[model samples]
Target: MTETLRARLARVGQSYAPHEHRPLAGYVAAMGAFGALAASLAAAAKVTGKPAPERPSLGDVALLSIATHKLSRLIAKDSVTSPLRAPFTRYTEPAGAAELNEEVRDHHSSLKHGIGELITCPFCLAVWVATGLTGGLVLAPRLTRLAATALTATAVSDFLQMAYDISKHAAEGD
Candidate 1:
């Protein structure tokens, strides 16, 4: 996991600026793909009476929740790099969650997030997709619901984190 993140950051160096120009056309194209994917799920759900195969399955609800955790870290990227992250970041080595957040922060800052995280949007989409997919699967009738609940809990945690960010940013704003 650590190696992969570093590799991405290192590899994307020049092209990943916050305001760099990538074609607006490219952005629209990506969103169109995303919308298509989203619509397909709904379409499928209507026919299947099952949850969309979202992004997970009955056997891997836990796995999907793990992705939700990663998404939260991304949202928290700024603080993860802050001095406060030092205490634990040192012990975590390579880069712990805080640093992970830092990387996410760096990503948003470095790249033109446009509407914000077109890349991140896919990830955020995945968590729900996984949940919806798992929900309708045959083996565990309850699994998808559990994943949805877990994802919701994770979202609350993420919200608190964002709220924290808002507070910090607000103070900085002042």
Candidate 2:
């Protein structure tokens, strides 16, 4: 049955984009997984008798925005995190600020290629990060806020460090 479904999907994909190696199957799977994750979070909340907040506070929203930005970049581009992405991406170059450039690997399986693309792009990873963080906010608000605050602090520190470097360079040039 799985093989038959795959064959039918391949035919449909071919009909849709004969010239492009589009990973429609992979995208479908990814979307299904995300849906499942969301459902699981909701189920857990119900099981625990936790109520969702009526609305997130502005401060929490700002904190989460910065935290998500930092985390998504860390996961997708940080040199230290390359091992996690190594299977899906090829090292291309240094991207400065302790970040690495990578290109998604072309695998025989379009699913793998699609996943690689997802893991390698910070913008793409942000949606997943935000979802997880939002879920965490509901499931464990204290822990989530603590973690988000730490990430936000680190992001602020990074900007300050860069600014200091620029000032030092300007002084030296003079």
Candidate 3:
């Protein structure tokens, strides 16, 4: 018996990433984890009087988490939707898988758009990294939370707007 298309797509996972390529979901998760760690370190350093090593911040974690969620949704959509589309449906035995294939395709399409929206812009990633650096700098005391606050706010808002734009793109089939 042949394996179903959904099974095949699900197996693809995010593992399809090239050896040199950064897996979007993995990167997003790492960013979130990194941010959480950094924030903990910052709070720790503040309490212990130990010098805070550079790290991510709460805002960073929030952004990273959002990105991770987006990518995860993408993977799920693709895995689920592809099996429902045509050609794949033809492979179904006894009954046609057309409905399944169509559903998969629609969701997969949405996810693909989400992926592009999540990571397509170089500036967003740049700002995200910069925000990390700025968060680290906040430990200096001279740097002040005011500056960090501003940057964090910018990062969050910018990402939110871009995310919205990406959704629009996906909805329009771009």
Best prediction by lDDT: 2
Query: What lDDT does each candidate get?
Result: 0.48, 0.90, 0.45
What lDDT is reached at residue 52 by model 1? Answer: 39
Please report how far candidate 2 places residue 6 from its true position, in Å.
Answer: 2.3
TM-score of each: 0.35, 0.92, 0.24
The total number of steric clashes, by the backbone 3 Å criterion, in model 3 comes to 7
Better of 1 and 2 by lDDT: 2
- lDDT of model 2 at residue 59? 95
Candidate 1: which stretches are off by over 4 Å?
1-20, 50-116, 120-141, 152-174
- CA RMSD of each candidate after superposition: 12.3, 1.8, 15.9
Please, what are the lDDT tens digits per residue for candidate 3 over residues 1-174?
134543443445436753433334433444565688667757866786756545756755554444433333322233344332332122223222221112211224323433343333334344444444444454454454444455455556757887898899999999
Per-candidate clash tally = 14, 0, 7
* Tens digit per residue, CA lDDT, model 2, 17-127: 999777777777778778998898899989998888899999999999999999999999999999999998999999999999999887878678878888888898898
Clashes of 2: 0
Tens digits of lDDT, candidate 1, 1-174: 255653565456436654553333334445666677667666766776655344544445555565455444443333433453332222223343244332222223222332234333445445445534443443344674565466666667767987898899999995
**With candidate 2 superimposed using the best TM-score fit, by how many Å does residue 155's alpha carbon deviate from the native?**
1.1
